[model samples]
Each structure stands twice: as structure tokens, then as C-alpha cells.
Target chain A: MNFINSDKIRKDFPILQRQVNGKPLIYFDNGATSQKPQQVIDVINRYYQHENSNIHRGIHTLSQEATNAYEKARTTVLQFINAKHNHEVIFTSGTTGSINLVASSFGKKHIHAGDEIIISTMEHHSNIVPWQMLCEEKKAILKVIPINDKGELLIDEFKKLLSPKTKLVAVTHVSNTLGTINPVKEIIKLAKTAGAFVLIDGAQAVPHTKVNVQELDCDFYAFSAHKMFGPTGVGILYGKEAILNELPPYQGGGDMIKTVTFEKTTYNELPHKFEAGTPNIVGGLGLAAAIDYMNNIGIANIEAYEHELLSYATEKIKKIEGVRIIGEAANKASVLSFLVDGTHPSDIGMIIDKLGIAIRTGHHCTEPLMNRFDIPGTARASFAFYNTKEEIDTFILALERALKMLL
Target chain B: MNSIKETQQEIVEEFALFDEWMDKYEHIIELGKDLPLIDKNYKTDENLIKGCQSKVWLHAELKASKIIFTADSDAIITKGIVGLVIRVFSNHTPQEIIDADLFFIDQIGLQEHLSPTRSNGLLSMLKQIRMYAIAFSTKADA
Candidate 1:
């Protein structure tokens, strides 16, 4: 195992230096948004300091340089996902926006009345609501693939829901609330066989797993940069060439047009047709830097590390009395959602926070999933590769103390 | 632990009762149970709170000086917590409601025990109660 230099790594993040309440900061909210490394931060700073100019339009030196860097960042993202073409990826604000893009453009174009759209029970509201909105407008029927008590998707049920009427099967590649890693490749295959387009919400999946969209063979994949240790305002939507070609342009703006005459306006090419405005230039560069950092560390290694952390934390926390771990899927990302017996989750979070530990408390943006599980939402401590087992130990110890405080 | 007269006074006197005074508590917990069971029929997209961890239906009404509160949760423990909240706030005078301190929450050591969302719910209950108090206070002002 290549041991991370904790002291060295700690120095990279400015926020990690601060204490919460009185305790040293232990951030376990990586599932929500990973802390950015110094390298990523510095790259962002450097761009603003030296290379802050608009891209593709300015013939001046700064514009050309900015344009090159921006396109280069796109290249970095393309390689990060191992996509077949650079044009396949379109930058949106985040995963929510990316899913909305497909729903608004493709969903509006393709689906007619009586057509079906399928999603899993464990999807975040972002995935659920947009489709619901589209279904209401388009007069399409939205079907859900129920999850078992164990928090695993019933693939058999998903298969049952599919038929000729199924236009799109939108599923979360990794469930945000439950941490269940759905068998998306297989789900995609089943959906494809039924002649439906599949869109995978890769938001929760991208930061933790090695996601190769081509191998998965989904029609579209979406993820956010913020969750992956990049800037917050940027997201990626990767669509297959054939699917990308079929959809009409999403937003009409300056760059998105080929030539705009008052009488008739033509559209631009593949990716640019979707990117309509002054893009998140700094955020794109920062995201590219983060991808570079992750790639350097190696995705497989990061995945293995997260697997180890989740197992280790689960084992430790489970030993405490009255601590019930939620979302115990056989295949999971790096989130540990649980409840401490006889204690309110807020109490657990507050007490632990005093010890300089930060974990997410509440529905995690999936109230329906919370309802499905018959829970108020679990206190979640999600991990990333930069996080250490010692941090988990500190968190577990703090939780034990927090639980006692409630008594 | 207090008698009905005392419970009535506590309800009338404290906004805190609406927060969790009822839940330490039998009257509000029972009232939470009274929360119409939120018919399985109505638990659709309309009733949902965007960030709430569970499906919660919060119902309140003002009678004389007191505001009656009732709620239900799909989750058992949350239902129990709601019962606590409704019991405390269901009956109170506007002046008494505003003047009463919620040390009882500190007494029960519950605010610390609640999950952040539940704490928000606890606060939401308080806000709902206080809003009623303010309304009653205004009615008198009128």
C-alpha cells in the first residue's frame, strides 16, 4: 500500500487547518463535496492572477491562451472518463443541471404521451423531480424500480418495468442516500434491449469509482465537479455520438449559434450547441486539475482505499451500542449512514462537531429515499482517498462519546 | 409529570412546549398520534417537504388563546418526537406562550439528541407555534 503523507496532505487544504468547536477538524462530508487540494486551488488562483480572459472569441494573446487552456481542460475531462471523443462531453453547472439538460432537450424531443420513463427508488430528488416535471408536460408515465429492504435495487423488477414504451431508463450509477452501487452496465443492457435510451446519474459514482462510460454503454452519463474535489459551478454530461447528434440544442445564446440572422438562425456543432454562455472558466480549469490529481493517484487505488475505509469505519461504528448502520448494500460507495440508539442524529453531529469532526446529518437530499427506508435520514460520514483510517478512528471515538452524552 | 391544570398552564405559558415539552410527554405524543394518520392516500408529492428526511404532515389550528398542533411521521421514532412537540404547544395563552423559556428542552437534553434535520423540525415546530403566538398577540394588538 502506498501510504499517504498525512502531514503533507493536510498542508494542502487551507480549511483543514481550522478547528471546529474546540476539536481539530475531521471532515467526513466528502460525499457532499470533497476538500480541494492545494494544487487545484493554486491552479485556480494562477488563472485569475495571470490568465483571466474570455475564450474562443478574443484574438488577443490572453484570449488565445485562455481558449487553449479551457479546451485543454476539456481534453483532461475526456481522458478522465476515457470517453471515445472530446465532443461527447458537455459542461453544465453540476450533476443536477446535467440531468436537466437531457430531460429538457432529449426528453422533450423524444418522448410522447403513454411513453414510460424508469428510475430506481433510491435516486436523489434531482434525478426524480426533473423527470417528473418532463413527464407531466409530455404526458409520459414515470415508473420506478423498487429497492429491497437491504437497499439493493431489484434488477428483476427493473427488467419487469421495461418494455417497448420505455423511452428512457434514468438511474443513479451509485445511490447517494444508500451508497448502493447499482449494476448499471447490466441495467443499461436491459434498457437497450428494450429499445430505450439510458441516462446514468454519475454524480455519486464519479468521485468514488472508475467510471468508463463506453464500457458501461449508457446513452448518457452525468456528474458534478464539486463532489470530485473540483470547483462547484462545473459539471459534465457525456453522451454517445449518436445520442448527442439526435438532440436539439438546449439553450440559445451567442456561442451556441452557427450564424444568427434576424430571419433564420442556424445552430453550432456538437458540444458547443449545448454550452450557451460565458462558461465557468476558472471552475473548468480547477476541475481539470482535480482530475489530473486523481489520475496521478490512480482511480483503482482510490477506489480500493475508499473500500477499505468504509469497511473499517462500519466495523468500528457497528460495535457501539445502539448504532444501527443504514444503507448496508453489498456493493457501496464510501458513505456510512447510521443512527445512534436513544440519541437524535443532530445530537450525534453536534457532539462530534465539538470534537472537530464534520459529518452530514439529515436526508442527504433524498427525502423520498428517507421515506422509503422509514427513517428521518441517517447521520452520514462519507470518506474520500485523502481521508485516513485515523480520522475514522477519531470519528468513531467521538461518536461513542456523543452517544453517551445523549444518555 | 405535571397535572392537567399544570399541563394546561405549561401549554398556555410556554412556546417551548410546542417545541418538545409535549414529547417528554404523553399529551402531545398522543396528539401526534391524533394527527389523522395522514391517510396513505395523501402521502404523495404534494405533502412532501423538500429536505425533510421523512414524510411529515404538520397540521395546526388556533382556538381562543391556544393553538392546536398535530403531526404524523411514517417513521416510528419521528412520530414519537412529533408527539412530544404537539403535546407541549397544543394549548397556551399568547403572552404565556411568548414569555415561557424552553429550558425543558435543555432539561430533557433533547436538542442535542435530535438529528440536525429533526432539530430543524423542532425549530419548525417552535416557529409554527411562535407564529401563532405572534398572530394572537397581533389580534389582541388589533
Candidate 2:
């Protein structure tokens, strides 16, 4: 097992050194978005300073350089997710954009009235809303797989929901609010048997664990860059080559067409068909730099370190009086969601903010999951590789102090 | 009932004693605990303020040409802030409410809650209060 030196890794991120509210910042909002490393920032800076040009359109040297860098970033993403081919990786605005692309294009091609789409109850709004819109448009049926009190999906109930009419199964690889690491391999296999395509919302998963699309055997995998220490407004969607070829272009414009005429226009091949406009060239480069930063630290080391932090925080939080953890899944990630006995989450969040500890306090864009648990929202502290056990200790102390005033 | 300016000055003075944010928050929480909550009948969905994090229910009625505002929030800090807002704006003429400039939130160093990104809906609550005042003032004219 590779051990991560988080203290050394912390130096790479400049934001970690800053203070908030006159105290050293203890950021536990990695699930929302991770802090960018200096390397990624530098790459973004270099792109604007030197290689600023439109990709795939200009014959100038700068354009060629920019295009090479952007395409190289796609290859980085392909290797990062262990994708089969380069064209299989498509750059979208974010995870939401990626899912929307698949939903719209796939729905246009295959879905019809009475078709069923299955999604788990723990899905984030990004994963849920796109499919709901698609279903509403195509007049298809939307089925939800239920979860137990511990926030684990009930496979038996999922099995019962599957049938020949099930067209697509969209689910999160990990619960953003609950920190539940779902069994996507099992889910994909089950969906395959039911003759439905699978699209894993890897927005939360790619940052925390090793995600091999081939191993998962899902038709589509979607994730965002910002959540994984890259620049915002960039994301990747990995689809099987054959499946991507079958789907129609999501949008029509420059760079997405092979040939355009007054008569008829044919769409470009593979990933370009999905990416319709001038892409975020710098964002793609920053994402590649972020991948390089992760490689340097070793993702396994980061995963193991974060798991330790999660366990430490969990055990300490359990000792706090009047605190109930919302998600206690047997297999969990680095997120800790909890509520005090008599205090509202926003109260705790507000109090702790004065102490310079930043944790997310709200429904976390998972209102249905909150409804399932019968709570308005939970205070969530999500850890990343740069976070230390000392930070967790400070967070717990801040939380305890906040609860004292609220209670 | 004190005038809006007097009530705002009094609350600001009270908050001034607490130099640290922790003490200010403690006072706010205490105020929340002692807040005269809105009536249960007014706690329906229609009266609920659209906050992303905390739920706030507000109700107002005119009595003897004065707007009596009662508000409650699920979150204690928000409730406490709401209590302060009510102290300044409640039991005043609708015209006074419509014309009152609320600078006490900044004076008390609680301006962060009023930020658009805070999502506690303190800004929205203030807007709702003004909306009520506007409606009642127009009704009085009629």
C-alpha cells in the first residue's frame, strides 16, 4: 500500500495555506469542488500566455499548438478512465452537460412512449433531472430503485423493477450527500441482463476511487473536472465507440459537421458530434495537468489516505452527543453527513463558518434523498487527499462548539 | 411601540457589546430561543420563504394601521435574525415599513447573511416584508 504524505501534498495547493475568518481554513467541501493545485493553475496560465488560439479550425502554428494540447488532454482523460479509444471521450460543459447530451441524443434515437428508465433514489439532481426531462419528452416511464435506511441500494427491489421495457439505467457511482459507494459493476450487469444501457454518474466517483470504464462495462460514464482539482466548466463523457456512433449529434454548429451544404449537412464522427462549439481549451489543458498531479501523488495513496480520514472523523463524530449520522452505509467514502438532535443544519453551518471551517450545509442538490431520510438537509464534510487528520480534529472541535451555542 | 429607527439603534447597540463573532452568535441563538414564533396556522406552505437551506415562514397583518409581522425559521440563527428584523419593522405603520432603511444588519456585522450566496434567504425575507408593506400601504390608500 502506498502511503500519501498529505503534509507535503498540501504544499501543492496554495488555497490550503490561506485563512478564513481570521483562522486557518479547514476546507471539507471537496465533494462540492476540490482546490486546484499550482500545476493546474500554471497550465491554465501558460495556455493563455502562449498557446491562445482556436482548436481544429485554424492552420496557424498557434492554432495547431492549441489543438494538439486540447486533443492531448482528451487522451489524458482516456488513459485516466482507461477508456478503449480516444474518440470515445467527449468533452462537455460538466457532468450535467454530459448526462444531458446522452439523454437528449439517446432519447431522440431510441426512446418512445411506455419505455422505462431506472435510477436510484440517492442520485444527485444532475443525474435525476436530465432523465426526468428525457422521459417527459419521450413519454417514457421513470422507475426509481429504493434504498434502505443505511442508504444502501436494495438490489432485490432493483431486480424487481427491471423488465424488457427498461431502456436505460442511470445511477450515481457514489452518493454525493450520503457517501455511499454503490456497486456499479453489479448494477451494470443487472441492467445488461434486462437489455438496458447503463450510464454511471461518475462526477463523485472519479475523484475518490479508481474508475475503469471497461471494467465497469457501462455504456456511458460522466464526470466533471472541478470536483477533481481541475478547472471548472470542463467535464468528460466516456461512451462505448459503437454506442456513440449510433447516437445522433446533440447540437449542430461549426466543428460538429463533416460537411455542410445548402441541401443537407452530415455530422462529424464520434466525440466531435457531441461537442458543438468552441470548447474550453484552457479548461481541458488544466484537467490534463490535474490528472498529472494526481498521477504524481498516486490515486491509490490518495484513496487510502482519504479513507483513513473518513474513518477517523466518523469515529470521533460518533462520540459527540446528540449527533446522528445520516448515512451509515457499510461501504462508504470520505463524506460525513450528520445532524444534531435539536439544531437545524443551517444553524450549525452558520456557527461553524465563524470558526473558519467550511462544510456544505443544505440538501446538497439531492432533495429526493433528503425526502427519503425525512430530513430537510444534513451538514456534510467531504474530505480530499490534501486534508489532514489535524483539520478533521479542528472541524470536530468547531462543530462541538457550534452545537453548544445552538443546543 | 418604538419607532423603526429607535428599535434598529437599540439592536445594533446590543450587538456592539459582543466583540467576538462567537459571542454575537451566542446572543443570536439566545434571541432565537426567545423569539415569539409565528402562529401555527400561518406556518403553511404558502407562507414559507423560498430559502435553499433554512425554512422561514412569515405572516403579517395590519392592526390599528400598524403592520404586525411574525416570522419563524427552522434554523436558529435565521430565526434570531428574523427576530431582529421583526423588532425593527414589526408594530410599525405600513408606510414606515415601506420607507425604513435597514442599516442595522451591517452595523451588527451580520451582513454576511444578506449576501446572495448565503442561501439562508435573509435577503428574501426582507424582500417579503417590504412586499407585504407595499401591499398593505396600497390597500390603506384604497
Candidate 3:
């Protein structure tokens, strides 16, 4: 018996009611992006319809209202993540933007030639590339912490890689491809012992679990709103106030600057320093609505229900012949990634798409992880709180149908 | 041998027999199995079309002014579509290959495979085919 009433919860999402290819849409691609609930959608629609205005500059009533709403959204995020201060939350494009902001700004201030930045093998391309670019520019060394066949990070190897020269440790809290929940609190503690700043990529983590930056004591945490049933093009970057103030601004534009001269310009304070331009005001509002929706259900309940779904799906998939489940970590989220023997993932994906089952089948932006597994990619079906056991059954039937056609 | 347009028409007609998407896919999977295998040597990175989802390798050669195209994909469905593409363009002159419009894919309900977002490199493979045609045509002119 699940605590979450997913059938009642399903009504909030209109996309769930729609059909695809003459079949009911079974959205298993939540790992790619989650479908927005009507509440979040309504907030966005209402904002654009009535309160559309550029934030923080104009003295107009609409501007003030939008500005207050956007700032309130920041506070909502701060409370949601249990951050220390509202100024610590900076709005960026998405998780990629947030990570890049740290890589660029933090790298500019602290990173020097021969300084080491550590990341793991399971990092998404967004997490890997920005650091790579930073390393290349600063002549810094980027060391990768390897994972085992089960996709769990080898902590012993991580300790070996850390030294006095280590400047920062960046890793995903939950891997997008493998769905492995990394021991980030332990990772952060270890990094602190090495005198390194820790930045956790919470893009995959925040949607499924409760994240407390204060409890974890990480220097930076990044996540996207779209993955959590909010609008796209908006994300939050929570940094320690002291470090964010010390680091240079990522981008230079209107809101980020205090005053400008031809030769000299003074940057704004924390939050505004990182957020350079007129931000995604409506996206921020939608994020607040999404956070409200989550709070209404309770994150603990969402976690428990999703875990049950993951377990149920995992057990059924295990019984399938010639199917290999990747990332068999002891701790995982609601992500099921697998490959059927003697069949390509894309062929399976194409066949199942016709059945109106949307699952992601590719490298999933973690090409290096695919290389580590010595496979091209895996077909992934990630579940959310709204996904029911019956939907999982339908997905299993679809998978079996796909396998029969391919094999 | 049928002209490229005639071959496309024949493919469209054959696909028209299947009303169900599953039947169409089954036919494609069967065609994929029957596709003439590209030489293993040509499966190198240089010949590989960079698709985000799947890998496709293509090799073309000219014999007596007629281009012969041999292609392969790790995915069976992509291979099947590639076989259809090869059927239309293979044994045709470079100019004819260059001039041919690929309407058969859309007609057969396989247009999604050719979408840029699909990332199977079918669209890229089609572009590569034309590039091969242009390269060979230039060689003939020179």
C-alpha cells in the first residue's frame, strides 16, 4: 500500500489524460523532462497574461510585483533546499548554466595552473565539459574519480585522487544515466578534509529526494526547475554566501552591476552578481508553484512512493530473458536503465514509441559513462510519483513487445 | 534496372500494403536483416556518420560511371531504412543520385527516422550520399 494517491495526483497533470498513437500516453521519460502539472502551468499562464514585466529595473507597479514574485521564488527555493540565506540562491538558465557559472566564476578567482578539479566517471556532459573548458583555459588538471561495474563510486580511489593540490570536487548527487545515488555528504566531508570546495550536481537528485545544502554543507548545489515539474529555462544555483561574494561574476549585464563607467564598473551583491540580466520572471513564479505542489504532497511521501515503483519495476524487468540492468547500485532513484541482448536500444525505442510509451534511449548525455560500460547506450524508463504500478505493467508489456519484434 | 524514382514508387507501393505500424516495422526489421552487409573494413570511424543515438557507416564506389552504395547501422530499423535508401540510389549515375528527391521515406511513414531530432543520422546519411555523389561527379568532370 502506497501513501501517495497517484491516481488522484495524476489528475493534476493534463498530459496524462492525452493519448498518443491511439494509445494512452505512458510518460517514462521523466528523466529527460517532467510533464508540468496544471497548477504550475496556470501560474505561468497567469504571469504572462497579467504580470509580464522585466524584473528589478522599472519603477512601474508591474515591475515591482514581478520583482517581488521573483525574489519570493528565490526564498521558496531557499526554503525548499534548506539553504542558509536567500542571497545564496542565484537564478541561471538550467543545471548546465548553474555549473558553468561556478566553473567560470569560481575558476577565475580560485583556480590556478596545476590546481586539480575532481569529478566522477558518471557525470553528465554538462558537468564534465564546463570543468574541462575551465581546466584547459587555466592549465589546471581535471582528475576523474572512477566507478565500479555496479556504477557505485569507488571512495577509496577518490581518496587517493584528493591531495593538497585539489581545488574543487564536482560530482552528481544522482547520476542521470545510471540513477546511482552518490554518497555526496561523504564526498563533501572528504573534500573538506582535502581543503577543496565541493559542488554537487543536484539536477537528477532534487526531483526525487530532499536536498539540504545546509545539512550537506556543500559549497555549491545546482538543479533545474523543469525536472521538478516547473517551467523550462530556469534553474537555481545555491552557493555559500562567502564564496559567491569572493568569486567574480559569471556574466556582466544590467542587474549584476551597481554602477558603470567607461573604464570602471562595480558589480552588485550576492544573487544579483551571478544573475546578470533580466531573469526568467515567469519561470521563477512557476518554480514556486511547483515547489508549492511538492510541499502539498510532502517530499517524504513522494520519495517513498517512487521507491516502491522503482522496486516493482526492477523486479519485473529482472525476470525478462536476455535483459541486462545497468547500474545495480545499492541506492538508486526511480531510474531503470537496461539493454536487451542482440538488440539495439534505438530499435527498441522506435518500436515502443509507436505504442505511445515515451522512454529515453541513448547515451543520455553521459557518453563517458557509456564508454565505461562498453556499450553504446541503454533504454531508460524513469518514473515519477504520479506513475502507477499498472503503468509499469503496461510499460513491461510494451518492452516485451519491443524485445519480441527486435529479437 | 528501375530508375531511382521508379524504385521509390515501388517501395512506397510495398509499404502501402501495411496499415498497421507494427506490420510496417516488422517489414522494415525483415528488410534490415536482408540488407547487404557493408564490408567490416569500412566500419571505421572515418566512414561512421555521427548520430547521437545510433552509429551508421556508409561506403560508396563508382564502377563504369554508376555509383554503388553499401551502408550499415548498429540498429536494425535504421539499417532497414538505409537499405531502402541504397536501393533507390545504388547503380545510378552521380548526377541522377544528386537529382533524386527522397519522398519514399515520408510516404512510408518513416519520416520520423529522418528528423534531425531523431539523431539516428538517417538525414545525415542522406546528406552524405549526396556528398558522395558530388565528389564522384567532380572526379568524372576532372
Candidate 4:
């Protein structure tokens, strides 16, 4: 296994150097959004500074340069995810936008009355609500695959949910709240057997692990750049060529048009059919730079280092009395969710923030999952490769002090 | 009964002594523990203050021409904030409750210490209290 020099890695992210309240900021909010490295920030700055113009349909030098760079960013994402074609990668605003694109375009065409859509109970609101809206619109049924006490998706329950009427299956590759890595490869195979299109919400997966669209063979895969240490306004939606061709255009606008007329209009090809407006060109370039930065560190190395951190945090936090860690799935990633016995998650979050530690508390945009657990929410401390054991020590100490004040 | 300014001054004096936020939070938690109980019947959804991370219920009744406000929260710190609010507003005339400027939150530095969401909840609690005062004051006109 390749080892990551975490101390060296931490130096690259400029935001990690700053303090929050009075102390050095220990950012444990990677599941919500990762801190951008200096490389990604510079790429965005360079784009606005030198190469700032709209992509496509430009005859000027800057436009051509911007178009090339933006397309190159698409190619970067294509290669990053190992997608079969460059045009299979469409740049949406973020994961929510990407999911909505698929949900609206593909869902409008394929989903029908009496058809069923299957999603897990642990899905983020982004993944769940779009399908619910689609189901409501089309009079289709939405099915939920339940999780075990350990927060693992029950494969048997998932199998039972799969049927011929199942038109689509959308599941997160990693639960943002629980950190449970779903068996997407297996889920895709089963969904394929049922003749259903599957979309994997990879918002939490891309930063922590390697994601190959060709290997997964998922019909649609969606993720945001911010979650992976890139700019916030951009993300990639990887749809299979044939499936994307079959789906209608999500919006009607300039770039997505092949020809425009009063009565007759033709839409553009593969990825352009989905991306309608002037894209976040600078953000795309920044995302590509982020991809390059992650590649340089090596995702496998990052994953290994993050896993060690997770285990370390889990072990240490569990040793503290009155602290119950939520979501102990057999296979997990870099998120830790916990609740103190006598204190609320909000109070814990507030108390810790005063000590210059940043952690997320609440339903984590997974209200259904919170309902499933029979709790309001949990205090989530998610990690990235740049984080360290010392930061975790500070966080643990802060949490202990917070618990003392509250309890 | 203490005037709003006197109550605000007392709170400012009390919070000024605690240098560490930890000690201040401990003090708030203690205040939460000491908050007087509301009637169980009053703790209903109708009295809920919207936009709180923790569920906070505020109930107000105009008894003997004075507005008595009773509030509760599931979270200790939020309940303590409610206690601070009750200390300033409860047992005052409806018009006095409506007319008074709530300077105590600023004096106690509660708004600065709270997270954005919690501060919004605090504002919501204040809004709810003022709203009850308005309702009762109008009924007095009726």
C-alpha cells in the first residue's frame, strides 16, 4: 500500500491553515464539502485572470481558448471516471442539479404510471426527493430499500424491492451521513437484470475512492466538484451513451440546440443535450485541476490514509463514556456520526464550534434516515486525506469539554 | 417586577464575569435546569416556534392584565435562551411586552455565541413572544 505523507498533504490546502474562532480550524465537514487545495484555487484564478470567455460558438481567440479548456476539463472528467466517451460527461451545477437532470429528462421519457423506482432509506434528500417528485408526477410507485441496524443496506430487502416494474434505481455510492459504501457494482448488475436504469449518487464517493463508470456500468452516475476539493458550482453527470441519447433534453437554450426555428427545433448531441446554459467554465477548469491534484496524491493512497484515520477516530471516540457512535457499517469510509447520551447534536456542534472545530449536526439532508434511526440527528465529523490524528485529538478534546458543559 | 433595562443589565453583568465560553455555557445550562416548568397542556404544536434546531414551545396567557409567557425547549442551551427571554418578558403588561426593545440578547452576547441557525431560532422565539403580545393587546382593545 502506498503511504500518504499527511503532514505534507495538509500544507497544500490553504483554508486548513486558518483559525475559526480563536484556535486553528479542525475542519471535519468533508462530507458536506472538502477544503480546496491551492492548485484548484489557482486554476480558477488563472481562468478569470487570463482565459475568461463563454465556451462554444466563439470566433475570438479567448473564446476558442476557453472552449478548448472547458472541453479539456470534460475530457479530464471523462478520463478521471474512465467513461467510455468524452461527451458522456455533462457539466451540471452540482450533484443536486445532475440528479435533477436525470430525474427530469430520463424520468420524463422512461417512467410511467404503475412503474416503480427503488431507492434506499439512507439516500440524501437530493437523491430521494427528485424521484419522489417524478413518481408523483407520473403516478409511479417509489420503493425504499431498508438498512440494517449497522446501517448496511439489506441486500435481501433490496432483492425483494427489485422487479420488472422497477423503471429506475437511484442509490448513493457512499452515504453522506453514515459513510456506508453501498455495493453499487452488484446493485447495477441486479438492476440491469430487472431491465432498470440505475443512477449512482457519487457525491460522497469520488473524493475518497476510485470511481470508474465503465467498470460500474451504471446508466447514470452523478457527483459534485465541491465534495471532492474542487469549486462549488460545477459537477459531472456520467450517463451511458445509448441511455443519454434516448432521454430528452432537460432544458431549452442556446448551446443545446442543433437548429432553432419558430415551429421546428433540433437538439444537440450526447452531453450538450443536458447542459443548456452558459456553463460554469472557470469552475470546470478548477474541478479538472482538483482531479489532477488528487491523481498526483493517488486516490488509493488517500483512501488508505483516510481509512486509518476513520478507524483511529472511531476507536478513540467509542472509548469515551456517554458517547454513542452512529452508523457502524461493516464497510465504511471517512464519516463519523455520534450523539452524546444526554446532550442534543446541535448543542454539541455549537459548543465545539466555539473551540474552532467545524462539524456538521442535523439530519444531514437525510430526514428519512433520521426518522429510521428514531433520532433528530447526529453530530458528524467527516475526514479527508489532508486531516490528521492531531486534529482528531483536538476535536475529541473539544467534544469532551462540550459534553461536560451541556451534561 | 424588574424593568427590561434592569433585567438586561443583570444578564450583562452575569455573563461578563465568565471569561471562557465553556464556563458561560455551563452557566446557561444551569439556568436551563432552573427554568420553571410550563403547564403540560401548553406544550403543544400550536405553540411551537418554527425554525429551531431544537423544538421550543412558547405559551403566553394574559392573566390579570399581565402577559405571563411560559416556554420550553428539548435542548438545554436553547431552553436556557428561552429562560433568559422569559426572565425579561414574562409577567409584563401586553403593551409593555410589545413596546419594549429586547436589548438583553445583545447584552448577554447570546446572539454572537450562537450558531446562525440557533440565532435564527432565538429571533423566532422573540418574534413568537411579540406576536403573542400583539394578539393579547388587540383582544384587550376588543
Specify the highest-lDDT model's number. Answer: 3
Candidate 2 lDDT over residue span A101-190, tens digit each: 999999999899999999999999998998899889889999999999999999999999999999999999999999999999999999
Candidate 4, residue A83: Cα displacement in angstroms equals 0.4
C-alpha lDDT of candidate 4 relative to the true structure: 0.89
Model-by-model lDDT, in order? Answer: 0.79, 0.92, 0.94, 0.89
Model 1 achieves a DockQ score of: 0.17
Clashing pairs in 2: none
In candidate 2 chain A, what residue range of length 10 has the lowest lDDT sum?
A1-10
User: Candidate 4: where are CA atoms >4 Å away?
Assistant: B50-52, B113-116
DockQ scores for all predicted structures: 0.17, 0.92, 0.96, 0.67
Q: Relative to the unseen true structure, what is the C-alpha lDDT of residue B140 in candidate 2, on a scale of 0 to 100?
A: 95
**lDDT (Cα, 0-100) at A137 in candidate 3:** 98
- Which prediction has more favorable lDDT, 2 or 4? 2
Q: For model 1, give the RMSD to the true fold.
A: 6.2
- Model 3 lDDT tens row, A1-407: 56798888999999999999999999999999999999999999899899999998889999999899989999999999999999999999999999999999999999999999999999999999999999999999999999999999999999999999999999999999989999999999999999999999999999999999999999999999999999999999999999998999889998999999999999999889988888888899999999999999999999999999999999999999999999999999999999999999999999988999999999999999999999999999999999999999998999899888888
Model with the higher lDDT, candidate 1 or 4: 4
User: Which is the better candidate, 1 or 4, if ranked by TM-score?
Assistant: 4
Winning model by DockQ: 3
Candidate 3 structure, TM-score to reference: 0.99
Q: How well is each residue in A142-198 modelled by candidate 1, as lDDT tens digits?
A: 999999887899988888999999999999988877789999999999999999999
Ranking by lDDT: 3, 2, 4, 1
For each candidate, what is chain B's TM-score? 0.58, 0.97, 0.97, 0.90
Q: Which of candidates 2 and 3 is the stronger one according to lDDT? A: 3
